[model samples]
Target: MQLFAFGLNHQTAPLAVREQVAFNVDGIENALRDLVENGAAKEATILSTCNRMELYCNAAKPEHAIDWLAEYHKLPRQELEPYLYTLPRDLAVKHSFRVASGLDSMVLGEPQILGQMKQAVRQAEQAGTMGILLHKLFQNTFSVAKQVRTETEIGANLVSMAAAAVRLAERIFPSIEEQNVLFIGAGEMIELNAVYFAARNPKRITVANRTLERAQTLARQYNGHAITLSDLPEQLAQNDIIVTCTASQLPILGKGMVERALKARRHKPLFIVDLAVPRDVETEVSELNDVFLYTVDDIAEVVKDGLEARQGAVKEAEVIIESGVSDFLHWMESRDVVPTIRALRENAEHSRRQELEKAVRLLAKGESPEKVLEAMSRGLTNKFLHAPTHALNQAHGKDRDNFLDVARRLHHLHNDE
Candidate 1:
């Protein structure tokens, strides 16, 4: 089966497009089943984060997989076409390895992507969508990722997007110590941002989420406060730094709402880092002179230059990944021939067993053992040579030359012999 990866990511798609297509955990399993049944793929797994929405699959037709993604997201193929990237086979395997190893993350060398990928695999397994091909590919993916981390400085001296948010916040006010930071969402990205912001000992910290309990749990960790999403508009003016990452398909903050917050904050320079894939803040808010709009990709740019600081290790990482890619592809190739190999071995065994059974029966009937043994040896030789003899006679041209060589090799029928 051909392996393919088709979808959008931080590089190909803007947040507007990627967010529209992001799949939640529950949505992933259903989408995977839909793909397999729709003849789009035989095995599928979707890895959806705020920054990327990639579908990895084993398939006969890559286009069918693309169509499945478009149809499921209810997006027009024409519109989706611009942002979608399609990788076949080797490139697909390389992309998977890159993504899982944190090389493809918004923050280079971050470890979160590895964990996220493992979660995706577990979800695929639970849905029964992970087949031998996908299972082995991911098994190698994790191993390669681990090797990259350990063998190279790929993860060294890396600045996380969350940490960069804090850096940007420092630029707004002379000191983060005086400002109150409000983190919007309780997701991993938000949690990380909040932790970084809280370390500054902000005047206060608050977490607002769709669920009050989740918000409360996160807020309590930092000795701050929790509020439901409903409180955001009213509470917006009170915070100086706002970091948001949520799974909401729609914009959490509109331009008008933020404008109102800016008006209330009295033209305060609000440092806003929207880590959400689709975005927590509306695009129009970026137009505001006083508001800073930092997207996931925007944050990615800040840490990018620093990754060069660890360039000594990249060549080593490539070697490790190459070896892993070779091993994984070899395993994938073997899977295709496995059944044929089994059938061939069974055929050979069956032929020998039948001849041996006949020999044993003759001996049981008190026939001469020597004649029985000779007959069995002749039967075994004939059975072994029959298929190759037929193949050599039937094949022609390239097929004939190849099969003749194969047959000669099989029976040790060399010119010298």
Candidate 2:
């Protein structure tokens, strides 16, 4: 099977299209197993983030994997086709390196994609779908990411999505210190945003998650209150600023929920950042007069704060990634020759064993040790030269010249010698 990757990312698809294919964290292992079990791939690892849904696989027919993706998501093949990008072999290797190094992220040089990729690899491992090719690819991928981070200023002055969310909130509110901040979901994204918002000393901070324990764990870190997702409706009205990123398959904050919250707050403006891919807030919520709803895509502009400075390091990072890709491809190419090399060694060993047995018999028959040793050495030399000599003798014209050249090279011979 060949190494290949195919998927749609934020660069090629809008948030709406991306969300349709987004694999929830809980179902990632199942998705990976299905991809391999369905024969679309020999091995597969899926990297699903807020910005992209990509599958890197070792497969004979990558198109079948693409078809599987659309089928799995229940999206028409035609509908998903426009945004899809397929990379083969070397291109796939380079793309993986670029992605892991954060060159391919919506927010350039952002470090979060690296962690997300590592998570994808872990999920693939848990699913038992990670085979040698993908394992090697990601191993090189992460190594390249580390090299880039160390050799370049790609991560310096990085404006993360969480920081960007806080910046957007600042625009909406005069003072974060006075506004009540409620974070929906206690995942990494929420925790990140919490760090940024908490630093501002918001009047009240709350974390809402599917499980209260997880919520409480995060809440206690910021000296905030915790609530289960079921408490959102009642708690929604109390917060002036809301940041949400959850793995829920459906919109958690519907238009009606926001409308009720707005009414309870006497139509005071509510700033909401929905960072989830399968959005936590309904699109219609953006239409509400008193509600300012921002999706992950909407945060892109704000996240460009240090983009100019980071761009300078991109070329440096690309150089490192390209070198990594070359090294990985070379390793793959060497692997391709391994079976041939093994067979060659095994064949030579068989010849040696046969000759040694004969030598033993002659010695047992009272031949001198010195004579036996010389005979055995001659036998080994003849056995090693026989195939090439026979092939060179049989060859004619250009083939003869090719065989002669190969024989000389194989034995490291020179015309002078």
Candidate 3:
């Protein structure tokens, strides 16, 4: 099977296109099963994060897997083809290593992508779609990531999306300590943002989710309060900063909701960061007066400031990743030879067993042990050499010379004379 990876990421596609093909946590298992059961791939792993949606697969033809993505997402193939990147074999292996090492992330050396990848692998495994190739690929991928993290300073001076959100909020307001912070959703991104925002010791932090129990769980971690989504209307105006990242397909906060909140706050400037892909806050909410709204893409500029400092670490990380890629590819090549090695050993064992059985029968029939042993040895040697000797005899000129060299090397013989 051939290894391949194809997808669109933060660099290749904007949030609009990326969100269109994003996979939900609940749908991943079915999607992976569909990819493998329908013959698009022998094994597959779908890594769908806020910034990217990549399918790493083992297939004879990548087109089938690519087509499956478009069809699965119900998008026109032509519309999505322009932004998609397809990497095959070595390129795929290299890309997987780099991605896991944080080399391919928008925020240079952010470590969140590595955890996101681990979650994707777990999903694939639970779906029962993970096979030998992808299993080995991710195993190597994780090892490379760990090596890069330990050997290089790639994660140094990193600016995560959560950190960027906090930075942006600080720019708008003097100090987060004086402002009440509102975090929507209890997902990984929201949890991380909560941690960063909590570090500033926001006056009052509130986690609002569809489920109060889940929101309460995250809220307690930061010594914050928890509320249901229904509480946003009454509680929205109370907070000066809001960071939202939810899986809701529809907008959680609309323009009217924010307008009312603004009126309640008496036109006090409110800072909002929408970290969701489809967007928890409506796009029209940005047009509201006295509101500073930022999306995930809007944080890109803030994330770039530390890029120059980490440039040197990138080179070091790449060196480690390259070494890892070479090792993984070598392992893959060795796996390819397993069948041949097994067959060769099996063939030799069969020949030896046949000769041993004949020798045993001769001894049982009262033949001398020395003679039987000699005959068996002769028979085994002939059986082992027959193929090579026949090929050598049939060879002529250049072919014969090449065959003779192969034989000499096979037997470790030297023409010292």
Among the numbered candidates, top TM-score falls to 2
lDDT of 2 by residue, 1-417 (tens): 499999999989999999999999999999999999999999999999999999999999998999899899998999998999999999999999999888999888888999999999999999999998899999999999999999999988899998988888888889999999999898888888889999999999999999999999999998999999999889999999999999999999998988999999999999999889999898988888988888888888888888899899999998888889889989999999999999999999999999899999999999999999999999999999888889988999999999878878977989775
What is the TM-score of each predicted model, taking all chains together? 0.93, 0.97, 0.95
Model 1: ten consecutive residues of lowest lDDT: 297-306
Q: What is candidate 3's lDDT per residue for 48-99, written digit by digit as tens?
A: 8888999999998889998999999899899999999999999999999999
Which ten contiguous residues of candidate 3 have the minimum total lDDT? 408-417
Q: Can you list the residue pairs that collide in candidate 3?
A: none
TM-score of 1: 0.93
Clashing pairs in 2: none
RMSD after Cα superposition, model 3: 1.8
lDDT of the candidates, in the order given: 0.86, 0.92, 0.92
Tens-place lDDT digits, model 1, residues 126-180: 8888987888889889999998998788888888877788887787789898988
Q: Rank the candidates by TM-score, best first.
A: 2, 3, 1
Error of 3 at 343 (Å): 1.0
Least accurate 10 contiguous residues by lDDT in model 2:
408-417
